[model samples]
Target: MMKRLLLVAGAALMSGLVIAQEPVAPPQVDLEQQQALRDAVSGTSRGITNVMRDAYRNPERTLAFFGVTPQQTVIEIWPGGGWYTEILAPLLREDGKLIAAHFDPESEVAFFRRSRTEFEEKMAGAPDVYDKVELTTLNYDPQLPIAEPGSADRVLTFRNVHNWLSAGEDKAALVFEKFYAALKPGGMLGVVEHQARAGTSLEQMIDSGYVTQTKVRELAEAAGFQLVSVSPVNQNVQDSTDHPEGVWTLPPTLRLGDKDRARYLAIGESDRMTLLFVKPE
Candidate 1:
């Protein structure tokens, strides 16, 4: 009996050694594919005006940080003026899908009507670039749906949260719920918004076109998402976040219109927060 027990023990030790000796797989890094995506971002087909914002926007790094790959379905909420649309549509045209969740077309607001017209014209003029692009409508109404539930691999929003907040906190929460519903389990939600100073009141956030990081996370968490990570890829340290016209006082908008235009230009764009959240599997 002792000899049999000894043999079994020896065999168990040998099996453990074999298991330890097995090779571990290395983490995957598709360098060639990544380079190709970066090339598309910098391509001249995007035009000069869009290229000018590349430095401030940091499209390549920002999208990479958000885990935006070339082969996944992505939904972009409120793509005002189609700033990111220009890059996203072309990059995803070959292998992936790009869905633009735009404002409700039936709205009587003149700005919404004109922006929709311009966006359609832009898309129409560039069939080669936007042929596969899909369109969906989003509104502040809680009953309205943004995209099909669990359909998108990723949902992205850029500087549009403040506009939702303008409708009120409940509406903003509903919008987040829609985003959460649109993404597949374990999918991502990437947000880039004007960052308010920490501890700013909700009233200030609503008034100044900025939001605290804490508030954003709380909203996401409340909507059944897990905060995955935050990236400083879009941070602008020079922005003081205290202008009379809120974020519009900065460049691009320059709401003051030559009243300290050079100073604001030196400050550059509004300081922004880039957050990545994931739906739990």
Candidate 2:
């Protein structure tokens, strides 16, 4: 009995020594930074609703899949109401840069004439956070100067591919080509948009403003981006893809009425594709 007790105590001491040698989790943004996010960004801005559930359901993993780190420069394309911006700016504050690329005021199809002031106001109060972020405005002219070549470490576009399909595939293609040119040789372009099925017809997608994974890959690859990997962390498997109004028929933008609310609610958010692409190193 005495020998057994000594062995047990020795084992316990060894376990404690092992644990003490283990590495600690990396340092992170403080409570004030997180509070700023909660105060400045609305639930709607994060696309939160009973329908669009993933933003709230899995935020850290979602941001992680975008290759977001505390050490890389990131550009958010057309940050509508600065939803991701609010979280991203503060999180990247200590060691990285956040560039909010807004549409030029002189251009048509600009969604953020008033968003500028709102974003600036939100950013203004957090000088330490905002100091790490830069606001860049550019016109979407195909013939003009935009982001410099090999400039950004990552370029992220969320839910804007549908607009490209509406504007015409060629128009979207040019923008993507520009996205390719704007990245460093090994930079990433992370895209999260409404996902049509694997076999959805391109013509139908163009009409309804939803694109298939294949279509997205095709466009990105054609523009010199190599398909890297895809994450289904944001996948919504409940959707049946038969909505009368396409993907928008499901949620916050539901164009349909009470007749289909239950049905769409059952479908939850539209299935989304989280694609990662990289230029050749």
> Least lDDT summed over 10 consecutive residues: which range in candidate 2?
18-27
Mind giving the per-residue lDDT tens digits that candidate 2 earns over 1-281? Answer: 99998898889898884233222222233455445434434333233442244453355556666656666778888776666776677666776778887666555554556667667776776676566778876445776434667788888888788777777788778778878877887788989888887787877786666679988888898898877778888788887666788877877668887876887877776778888888776
CA lDDT scores, all candidates in order: 0.86, 0.71
TM-score of each: 0.88, 0.74
TM for candidate 1 is 0.88
Query: Candidate 2, after superposition: displacement of residue 274 in Å?
Result: 0.9
| Highest lDDT against the true fold, candidate | 1
